[model samples]
Target chain A: MSSSELLQFLISGLQSGAIYALVGLGFTLVYASTGIINFAQGEFFMLGGVLAVAGVRIGLPLPLAIVAAVVISAGVGVAMERIALRPRRDSGALVLIIITIGVSMVLKSVARHAFGPNEMALPAFTPGPPVLLLGAAIDRQVLWIWGLTLVAVIGLTLLYTRTRLGRAMRATSLSHDAARLMGIDTAGVVMISFGLAAALGALGGAAVAPLTQTAFDAGARAGLKGFAAAILGGLGNPIAAVLGGLVLGVLESLSVAFISSTYKDAISLVLLLAVLFLRPQGLLGKSGREKV
Target chain B: MKTRRSVLATVLVALLMAAALSGCSGKGNGGSKAGEGGDAPYRIGAIVSLTGSYAGLGTPEQKAIEMEMKRINDAGGINGRQVEVIFEDDATDPAKAQAAVARLLEQENVIAVIGATGTSQTMALRDDIDRAGVPQVSMAGGSVITAEFDKNVFQTPWPNRIVVPFTLRALKDRGLVDVAVISDTGGYGKDGHDLILKGATVAGVKIVADETFNPGDTDMTAQLTKIKSASPDVVLLWNAGKEAAIVAKNIKQLGMAVPLVGSPGNGRREFIEGAGDAADGFRFAAGKILVPEAYGEGTPAFQVAKKFIADYSFAYGVAPDIFAGHAFDAFLVVTDALRRIEGEATPASLRDAIEATDGLVGVGGTFAYSAEDHNGLTEEELVFYRIEGSTWVLDK
Candidate 1:
């Protein structure tokens, strides 16, 4: 590929990669506090976009619609934790995982029925001609994704480093029993983390919806990709998941260009497999320190 | 690891379902099926993609089928035999389609089947349909449905082979020779891709570059960039479902100014809505039903399409999509055949009668089935549409 052509692919990859990062961050946040992989992470993403579309359809402004979507999705996340998991706190990991999958299925079915089977579209945050960067036409939505992602990461960092609640969540993630003994209301932190994770995922979905139209079942793919991103970065390691998402996106775009576009997923799989085999702890993850 | 397991499980179930499907169809024990009694309402079966990937297509198809069923029953019910439709949701999975077809054939004992909206589902269900000695009028528009013709499978929509030439002819008219074809690996996409390759070859057009994308891949900038490098005169995108709209955005995002011509699958309002302004100036060849006036005033095709659009909109409170028209046509074909059967409306009787379908005009245009040809629509039924000012304007 020529330099400009390569830049075009990279820019596109980053745009999508940002989505993966945000979704992955959701997974990381939930896993960090709860010690459970919420399989419905994708469903949360879907709810965000679907709700946003609904919001717009009902005459809300785009910004208000997005806020509504995030809030609703966060409420859904909390509901899932409270109704499904909080009662089954003593259940095995496999059972909890299965319940999350069940939650995802139920959410998908509800969306399918309520929304109908149409791809919902929302106007871009800024509508007009796309900006030209190095001969590559970049949709303005990509900037929204990157800027919001930056804000989210920075805000999350501040929360973790500057806030007592964030420290309590961290301590809980490190050792639930120890944190509880240290008088850290670990359950509240867990609930808060689930809400935060869902809000983050909803934000990602809203950001990407204009670029990629949201389908009722689009959540499964996003969820799987986000899950892959989380795993690639090592579960519970927030920073690494974002980087992992970027790396995965770039790898996918480059593979499509250099090899054949058909095998991009296969290429990603090979790379993911290689990573799992070679560095189980992920790039930025330390041994057992960040494991969920 | 979870994804891997799920993929493996899906494959295994698919293989087992295929095996069961073939066995179930090959058994010519239609007499022993549950719907054997001649006393009940005439049973028709429909297998539609109600949930999965093709749900958008199948939901409308299902709604249309229901509306048609109500109209038929209200209008004295196919020569006094009350028409009862047993609808099954395939979830757009081939395995699910297979299971649904089997249930329809073995349990419901439907005289004929009308859907499973996507090509893959239709293709998967065809073998069992043929084995049960039941005719299936498919709503999906894949060349493979009829190209590899089955005596029992009759397609109602204009297939890829027909739609491709129209778009290609338009491209050639504009002196656009070099073409870049992008196809999704989904059933419709793969079929249309291969046909576009053939269509371009037949038109003496050189393929500058071709790219394939899977269903869920979010970005096409890589492929578009490669196509830009090749500098094709125009790009032909042949993918069904929402992904095609995404391709339009990808084209806009990558600054690839090449004109995009799509298959009939991209003819839906969903595509235009999803792609937003990116859909501006996009063109494709689809059934005249999308633009009824294109068939011209007082023409039989135009009148039928106009009524369908009107009746569908009135009945459902929503503008009917292409798939709805396909389903409407298929339902009409089956019911129309049933009306002509001399004696009992058995599976065999319906099969032979459908095969003899002549000059049957519906939303998908005039369908005429012959001894060898099961797919009835031709290129004449298609019209060229351009997205201008966020509306589908028939290209004069």
Candidate 2:
């Protein structure tokens, strides 16, 4: 293939990679704090996009609509933890994971009813023609996705290292009993992690909605891809998850470009299997860490 | 305090369960057998996608069927029996459609089946229908429904076998010879993809680049990027889902200058609304419902279409799409055949009568079924339209 064609494929891959990274990061945060995979992470993403569209339709300004969507999604995350998970906190991980699957279904049904089962779109944050980079056209909404994802990563890094609540969360992820004995409100830290993860997912949804168009059923595929990315990155490491997402996206794009479009989705499955067999701890994961 | 909270939670759960039970019971309408010394209603089963991707097509189809049912029953019944249609929501899945047809045949005892809105769902219902010996008038447009003809299966909409060559001829007439096709891996798209490949040779068009994506895929840039490099004259989209809008937007995002053409599947309000500005200038070949003037003024077909459009618009506050027209014709085909049967309307007789339909005036066109042909519509019933400013303008 020509270099320009290769560049075009890379651009497309990076745009999708940015979204997978944001969603993967959400998976990592919740897995770290709660030890339960949140299958509903994608539904939060759907809620953000569709609710933002609804907000815009009901006369909210674009910025205000996006902010309202993210805030409401965070509230939903906290409410899910309080109402569904908290009462059954003593239940084992398997039961909790199944509950999360149920939550995802409920959220999808509710969104379908509320949004009327049609695809919805948000206007790009900056409306302009695509910028041409050496024969590749990059959509303006893609730039927004990349910028927001970078901001989320930097913000998450600072929170994990510099804040007291973040330290408490880390301690709880390490050992819930020991953190409680140390006088940390581990339960509250779990709730905060859920909120933060939801907000991040919603932000990704809002950023990509202009490009992909959001529907109630959009969550199932996104959730599956994001989960694959998390597992490919060893499931618990946030930074590694981001890198894993980019790699997966590029691999999928290149497969379509070089091999065939028929095998595009198979790339994720193949990568997950390869990672499991070859590098079980992921590319950047430490070898001695617990397998999440 | 803990006990009081638990009690409140129990009460809430009880209320929720009660509401859900009520909703389930209310879904099936007019299936009563207690008829107060009169004949029971003529039961017909309709399998539609009331809640999934094809919901846009099926919702209007359901509305059209329900409206016609109410009208037919209000006019002192057909042959002294009320017409009642039992509806099942397939949710746009093929397996659900198969299960629904089984229930309709074994439990509901419907005389005929009207639909399962999408192509794959319609195809999925064939086995149960043939086993039950009931007539099925499908609302989907896939060619296989008739090309792989079942004696009991008839279709209302024009199939892809007819529409594909018409579209290829349109492209050739405009001197846009090189074609790039991006079809979905679903039944309808697969059907169109095969036809386009075969028909391109006869229409003197070259296949420059052909790519496909699976259903529910959100991005088409990778496929479109490859298509762009080949530099085709036009892009023909062959999918009915709302994802077609994504293809339109992706084409624009990549700055591809070629015009985009589509199959009959792209002729929907959702395609226009979902694609927004990207939908403008899009072209497709479909029936005359979008611009009913193509039916020719003062003809019988024109009068029927005009009346249905007026009544449907008055009832729903929006114009009926081609799917609604297809539903109208399906109901018309069945009812007209019922009126023609000289003896008792049994399943075998209904199936034969539907196959023998002739020169019926309906919204789609004048349908005439025969032993050799089931999809009775012709190219004369179709017209081309170019979208402009969110509405279709007839393109001569």
Candidate 3:
């Protein structure tokens, strides 16, 4: 590929990589606090986009619509935790994971009925012609995705290090019994993690909706990809998950351009397997942190 | 011991009574109403993609079928037997479609099967349909459905065999001879992709670049970027799912100035709605229901399309797209055949009657099925449409 063509593919990869990173953050957040994978993370992304579209149709401004969507999706995440997971707090990890799968299915069905079976798009935050950057065309939405993902990452890092709740969440992830003995309300931390993860995912969805339209059934494929990204970056490490997502996106884009677009997923799957076989802890993950 | 034996016998008798009563209830209205002489309903099975990637297409198809069923039964039924449609949701999976067709044929005892909304799903029903010896009127537009030539199968829409060559010729006439084909790996897209390759040679066009993506993929920028480097005169998209909108948006986002042309699969309101302004100037070939004038003023075909559009819009609060028209035509073909049956309406007799159909006016143009040809519509029934301002305008 020519230099310009390589740059074009990289830009495209980074755009989708930003989205996968945000969804991976959701998976990392829930897994860190609860020790269970929230399979419904992709539904939060779908809800964010679909709700934003509904908000825009109801006459809200674009920014306001996105904010509303994020807030509502966060609320849904909290509700899911309280109604489904709270009662099953004593349940094993396997049971909780299955419950999350059930919740995702219910959410998908409800979204279908509420949004109807059609793809919906949100207007660009700043609609204009593509910005030509070094002989490569860049969508304005691409900039929005990168900016929002950075903001989410910085904000989450601050929350983890600076806030008391963040410290409590860390302590809980370290050892649930010890954290409880230390008088930390670990359950509340878990709930907040769900909300925060959902907000981050929704923000990504809202930003990307202008580029890729949202639909009722958009969650499953996105969820699977995000899950793969989370696994690629270590399951519990949030920062590594983001890096993993970016790596995955670039890999998929380059494969499509250089090799074959038809085998992009297969190529990604082979790489994922290689990562798992070589280092099961993920790229940035510490070994022996998770038990099989 | 004798007392315990008597109690067990009583319990068994109660269980048998419950089973007998439940069996009677399971028969529904069909058993009670089958008194004699055409009081029974003509059961037809409809397998639709009510929940998956093709849900947008199948929802409209289900609505059109239900609407037509109401109209036909309200007019004192089809030859004194009310048309009852048993609907099954395939969820856009071929396996589900196969299972649903098996149940429809063996259990529901439907005289006809109307759909398996998408091309792959429809093709999946062939084994069951052939085994059951029933007439299956498909709503999908893949040419393989008819070109493969199953005697028991009939299609309502213009197949890709007719549309692909016409589309290629149209591109050639516009002085756009170089083509870049981006098709999905699904049934309809794969089918159209093969035919496009064959027709490009016959239509005197050069195939410059070819790329494909799987269904449900969210990004096509990489494919479009490759196409950009090749700089084809036109980008031909062959996909029936909602993902077609993404290609249009991707082309616009990448600032690629190539005109995007699509197959009949792109002829839907969702395509315009999903792509927004990016959908402007997008072109596809489809039937005349969008612009009834394409049927010609005061023609019988025009009158039928006009009524269907108005009725469908009133019922659903929006205009019917080509999928709806295809479903309407499928229902019309089956009911029209049912009306023409002289004696007992077995699947064999109904299949023969449908094959003998000639010159019946309905939504995707007039129908004329034969023993040799299952898809009756020709190139004349199709017109080129350009999407302008999120609505399709007849391309002059």
Best by lDDT: 3
TM-score of 3: 0.94
Instruction: Tell me the lDDT of candidate 2.
Output: 0.83
Alpha-carbon runs more than 4 Å astray in model 3:
A288-292, B1-37
- Candidate 1 chain B, poorest ten consecutive residues by summed lDDT: B22-31
lDDT of 2 at B232: 98
Q: Write the per-residue lDDT of candidate 3 for residues A1-292, one digit (tens) a residue.
A: 6888889899888877888998999988887787777878988999999999999999999999999999999999999999998998887666677677778878888898899888887888999988888888888888888888888778777888899987888888777889999999998999999999889888888887888889987777777778788889877667877888999999999999989998998998899889978986679887753421
Candidate 3: give the clashing pairs. Answer: none
lDDT of 1 by residue, B106-216 (tens): 887788988769999899997798788888988988889999888888998888888888888888887889999999999999998888887777787888999999987
Displacement of residue A139 (Cα, Å) in model 3 is 0.7
The parts of candidate 2 lying over 4 Å away from their true place are B1-38
Q: Name the candidate, 1 or 2, with the larger lDDT value.
A: 2
DockQ of candidate 3 compared with the true complex = 0.30
Ranking, DockQ, top scorer first: 1, 3, 2
Each model's C-alpha lDDT? 0.83, 0.83, 0.86
Q: Model 1, B255: alpha-carbon shift in Å? A: 2.4
| TM-scores, each model vs. reference | 0.94, 0.93, 0.94
TM-score of 1: 0.94
